[model samples]
Target: MAIILIADSGSTKAEWCLVEGKKKKTFFTQGLSPYFLTGEQIQNILEEELKQKMKRVMPDEIFFYGTGCANPNNARLVKKAVQKVFTGATVAVDHDLMGAAKALCGREKGIACILGTGSNSCFYNGKKIVKNSPGLGYVLGDEGSGAYLGKKVIQHYLYSTFDADLMDRFDAKFKTSTTEILEAVYKKPLPNRYLANFTVFLAENRGHYMVENIIEDGFNDFFFNHVYKYRESWTLPVNFIGSVAYGFKDVLEEMCHSYELQLGKVMQKPMDGLVKYHTN
Candidate 1:
């Protein structure tokens, strides 16, 4: 039986699946984004984390999909790194959005979206992504994402726009000052991740009108800027894969209803769908 290995990665983590005939195994490692890690670093992760997990079995084929891999140079960096780890394996690398498209839409035409630390969307025409809205990362875009939600929450908190009860709760939960928040956002590395971390607070306090409003506004921006731009959005099923979408599914559904969007599936992780896509 031929062995196949697949990886779906984001900026924070990588999920790996190894398929040997009918048996499959899943594991995780640090993310392998070429935007953040060097070829040496990616190779080191595969050698130290993935190679050890597979033990005696080496894959015949390796498919790696990761953020920042839309660029050919980035894709080459990831492919080269994977090749170094398994010299005998055929390595294929592509963008994480493509992986999402395959996982969410399979061989069917639909709209695929990612709402994690950051956000992105594309119109997938069965075999490939025919159109994509520019995902300008967390700095300029990524509306309706965890980072975006957290950013709005922070803004409201800093501006004292939250209700008094919510304000007390926010202070009690974070015990942080405006200076600290600004420092983390401006000076720290991976500000997007740092910003996304605050979504936990929103999750904990879900259903509160204040929290709901913030999340709803973010989702609205996401649809307005990204999803709505696709002509197929009106006719096709819009599917999503990511933590934010899965976490606030009710709000997402409400927003989709508001927009009259045909909501498909919302998956926290795309690995399971990807496994089926590849195995079949």
Candidate 2:
């Protein structure tokens, strides 16, 4: 029996699945984005967390799909880290967008998007990514993403846009001060992640007009700027894999309707589909 190990990672977490025969074992660890963690740090994470989970079985092949693996340097960094741990396995590292394409589109051509802590998209022709829309990280872009939504939420709160009831609810939920918010956004390491944490508030206040407007505008920007730029946008079924898309699915669906685009699949995570793709 061939043992295949697969990892799907984002900025916040990584889901690892080990497939042996028909049985599968799952494990999790903090994300290992090359933009944030060094190759040594990634190796350390696998050695300390993932290695402990896989007690006995050694895999013949390892596939790692992660956020910053598009760049050759980043891909090399992750590949070296994985190779260091499972010395005997043939390791392959690629961008998370490719994994989303494989998971969502399968063997068909379509548009694949990721709207988690960050956002990215690509045109996939069944086997590989053909054209890509720039993600631009959190500071410049990431429209329709958790981080983007959270930024809007905080901006409203800080700028006194929330009404009395909403203000009270926000305070009750977070109680965060301006000083702390500034520090986290400017001085902290993972500012994008820090911003994305506020999406819980938006989720909780889903029905409010203000909240709905914010979400709608963000999704509109995403479609207008990224998805609409592709020549295949009207012809293809747009698929999404991310937390924000699943959490705010109603708005996502509405946005797709407004834009006259077809929404295909909205998966919170791509691990299950990826397992099938790799195993088969």
For each candidate, give its TM-score against the true structure.
0.97, 0.96
lDDT of each: 0.92, 0.90
Across 1-280, the per-residue lDDT of candidate 2 in tens digits comes to 7799999988678999999989999999999989999989999999999988899689999999998898999999999989998999999999899999999998899999888878889999999999998888899999988889999999999999999898999999998899999999999888988999999988898889998888888888899889999889799999998889889888878888988999999999999889888877
lDDT by residue (1-280, candidate 1, tens digit) is 6799999988778999999889999989998889889999999988898899888799998888898999999999889889988999999898999999999989999999999999999999999899999989898999999999999989989999999998999999999999999999999898999899899889999879989888888999999999999999999999999999999999878888999999999999889898899889
Model 1 vs. true fold: TM:
0.97
Off by more than 4 A, model 2: none
The deviation in Å at residue 112 for candidate 1 is: 0.2
Please give the range of 10 consecutive residues that has the lowest summed lDDT in model 1. Answer: 47-56
User: Cα RMSD to native, each candidate?
Assistant: 1.0, 1.3
- What is the alpha-carbon lDDT of model 1 when measured against the actual structure? 0.92
TM-score of 2: 0.96
Residue 37 miss distance in model 2 (angstroms): 3.0
